[model samples]
Structure formats: C-alpha cells, structure tokens
Target: LLGVGVAQLADYTQEDLFAQALREEAAEQEQALEETEAEEEPEAVVVRRWLPGQDVRHAEFGPGWVQGSGVGRVTVRFETPWSEPGRVRTFAVDDPALEPARPLPLRRGEGMDGEGE
Candidate 1:
C-alpha cells in the first residue's frame, strides 16, 4: 500500500505532463518543418560556351587544342598547358583523335573519368 501511494503521488504520475511534452515536441517539429518550407531554394542554371586554350586529347594525333579550327577541319595546336605551342595539326572534326573531353578537375568522385563507361 505504501509503494502504491508513493507511485500515485510521484511527479511523473501526472499524465498531463507527458501529454504536454509530446505536444511541445510536435509543435517544435512542425515549426521546424514550416521554417524549412518557407526558405527559398536556388534553381540550377546551365551555360554552355566554347573556351580557348582548353585541354583536349585526341585518339590519333594525341593531346592538342588551344589553336582553333577551320572549315572541314580542326587545327589543334599541339601543346600542353605547361609547354609552348608545339605544331598545328589539321584533322576532320570526326577524326579519331578529335574527341570532346572534360576539362581538368573532371567530375570527381563519379569514377567515370577515362573508362568511357
């Protein structure tokens, strides 16, 4: 009987306290969700433009670019970013060596660099 009385008189015995705590927690969560929803998220914008002196590797003639291209041909000025202009080689746009390539610092962590996968 003593134990039952003590439990009955315990501060935690009030059911309203637990209910209020739950209500407060739920309110906090709802407020957080509302705040997150209210915040604006930026939209993604894509821009594509050809750049000069970019790195390009060809399958036939090897790495080249930085020069320019003309009618029916792409004249790649053979030279790496670290060296002077080597020689200008003309090749068809569909040439095996002339292939589009991703700039340095390629899509990291994708594990899809040169595998062509």
Candidate 2:
C-alpha cells in the first residue's frame, strides 16, 4: 500500500505534485468562473418509480438506496452491507447519473441492525 504523501510511486513526489498544481488549478478555476454566465434552472423531473429501500447507483458515487424521492429530486443514502451509515445525497430525479440497482443480500455474521451486542 501507500502512505499519504509518504511514498512516491512515480517520477514526481506526491507533495510536489499537489503543491505545484494547486496554484494552477486555482487560477484556472478563477478564469473559468469569470467567463461563466448564470443560466436558468431546468424543469423539475419526476421519478415516480423509486420507492424506499430500493437499491440504486450513481454514476459517480457508486451503489446506494433511495431514502426518499419527490419534487424533482431523489435522496440516496450511500451505504453498503459492510459499511457504516453512508452519506446522503440529493439529485435531480432525471439526472443521467442516477439509476436503479439490484439489492445485495445481508450475509451471515452481520446482524440485522441491532443495538449493543
């Protein structure tokens, strides 16, 4: 494995890479924002197919389940069987990145959400 900025895998050092690029990235962002113009909000999207406990995947955030959905947005709590409670994220119901996914079964050895053992 690798440590944070402790080991270098490539010709450049990790610290050196980030330290060098930080200013460049900030400059680029500043310029881009200056050139950008405000845009109109898109229409609300309706995702009636979603229901509580339904498994889903986000194009960028990976697998999760629908916690709630309505008013043009779908809220997902991205947690897996092996993970602690995951973070929640809201997305446009029609957002291209959100999609339905198959639910993973609860394997043995893992409790069904009980209190202190």
Candidate 3:
C-alpha cells in the first residue's frame, strides 16, 4: 500500500540527514547558553581504572579482580588459584562492596619460561 507522499519522504529524508549532520557538527559543543539556565557538563564520560587479573576484594564476595568495565560499572570474577573459577559479578564504580588488593601468585611454573615443561 502507498503510505506517505513521495515528496514527504524526500523532504523528510533530507531533513533527517540534515539533522544527523547537525548533530555530528555539534559533537564537541559544550558551551552553556549565556541567557539560559543550562549548566556545564563533565569533560569526560568516565575513567575506568580496574584492570584484568588485578587483585580486588569484595565485602561479601571475598576477593577478585576486574574482568571488564563500562557504562559506569565493573564486572569481576571471584576465585582463588587453589579453588575453582569464581562467579562473575558487576557493581558500580564506587560500590563499597569492592576494594583493591594485592595480586595473586601464578600457577606452578607459569611465570617461568619453558623450563618447567
């Protein structure tokens, strides 16, 4: 079935493309309106500091390092070398449930070269 008019799609398509180009043009525009009530925004989105294999301890989940981080959150896998792999958990960047800890030792002969083999 025929929907909108032919010119409508073309006009709106042009308008939509113009809007997209406008947004891309304003990609770095952060100045507040001098006559408006707008407020200044943060310079950057966020800075995730957690790294994989880094030592970390959770209040209830014990200890684990960061598996990955994004969207103002971090994922962690908790487990000790002697035990099975730990469960994965995600928490806020400032969640009191987690804290940094010392790194763990590698498995037998893992750090050394092929000498162990």
Candidate 4:
C-alpha cells in the first residue's frame, strides 16, 4: 500500500496530494530506520568475571596464584563467574617458566619412575 502511494505520487508532476504522500512516506521510512537501529544496538556496558586455579601472570609479580592478596600494589581476583574475587597481584607476564605445562603427569610412582623397583 505504501509503495502504491509512492508510485501514485511519482505519476503526478506537481500536485499537493502527491507532495503530501511523499512527505508521509519519507517520515515513515525514517521512523522504521530508527527503530531498526535501536533494536540492533548492543548494551552500553559489559562485565567479565575472573576464575580461580587458572594460569595467569601479571606485568610485575611474575606467576603466583588463584590466591588472595592484601598489598596495595595489586589486588588479585577470581577469574570465573562462580567464585568471589580472590586477589590481584602485580606480576610480569614474562616469568622464566610461566608457560603451560604438558598434559602428562609431572612424575611417575616409585616403581615407574626408576628403572626397577
């Protein structure tokens, strides 16, 4: 129906009715565009939670913990959503051996570790 109104408006070169219909159409389209833009927009703010036992390092303290802290330099906090904020530490991302460990166990049992029991 709206398209029909626009087509009719185009047919007449310069009539008051055609001009009015065009103006109405332009306004309707503008309103629809605004609604679409508003709906597509995301929230203004987002929050991320920290967790415990996860591997992490800071810019100064080296590698430490999922543990809590009390110092003023940094306050460690839990990374997961389930746990409370633990603590923050000022650590270096570059500790000599801060990289992830291998999937295998750190060491074998007495019999397994040695050549023979």
Task: Name the top TM-score candidate.
Answer: 2
- Candidate 3: segments with Cα more than 4 A from true spot: 1-48, 106-117
lDDT of 2 at 51: 84
Per-residue CA lDDT of model 2 for 1-117, tens digit only, reads: 465563455656766899779989999998777656323445555555678889998878877999998887889999887779999999888888888876655663444333201
Winner by lDDT: 2
* Global lDDT of model 3: 0.72
Task: Give the Cα-based TM-score of candidate 3 against the true structure.
Answer: 0.48
TM-score of 1: 0.39
Candidate 3 residue lDDT tens string, 1-117: 577568657888999999998887676353334323334544555544777667788889886778988788889998866568889999988787688876654574455343221
Instruction: Give the range where candidate 2 is weakest over 10 consecutive residues by summed lDDT.
Output: 108-117
lDDT of 4 by residue, 59-103 (tens): 343333444222322234323333344455443333333332122
Candidate 3 worst ten-residue window by lDDT: 30-39
Q: What CA root-mean-square deviation does each model show from the true structure?
A: 14.3, 17.8, 10.0, 13.6
In order of listing, the candidates' clash counts read 2, 0, 1, 21
Candidate 2 ranges with C-alpha deviation above 4 Å: 1-48, 108-117
Models sorted by TM-score, best on top: 2, 3, 1, 4
Q: How many clashes in candidate 3?
A: 1
TM-score of each: 0.39, 0.50, 0.48, 0.25
| Consecutive 10-residue window with the lowest summed lDDT within model 4 | 97-106
lDDT of 1 by residue, 39-115 (tens): 75565443222236656776755556546655556667765445565787766655654666654443444444564
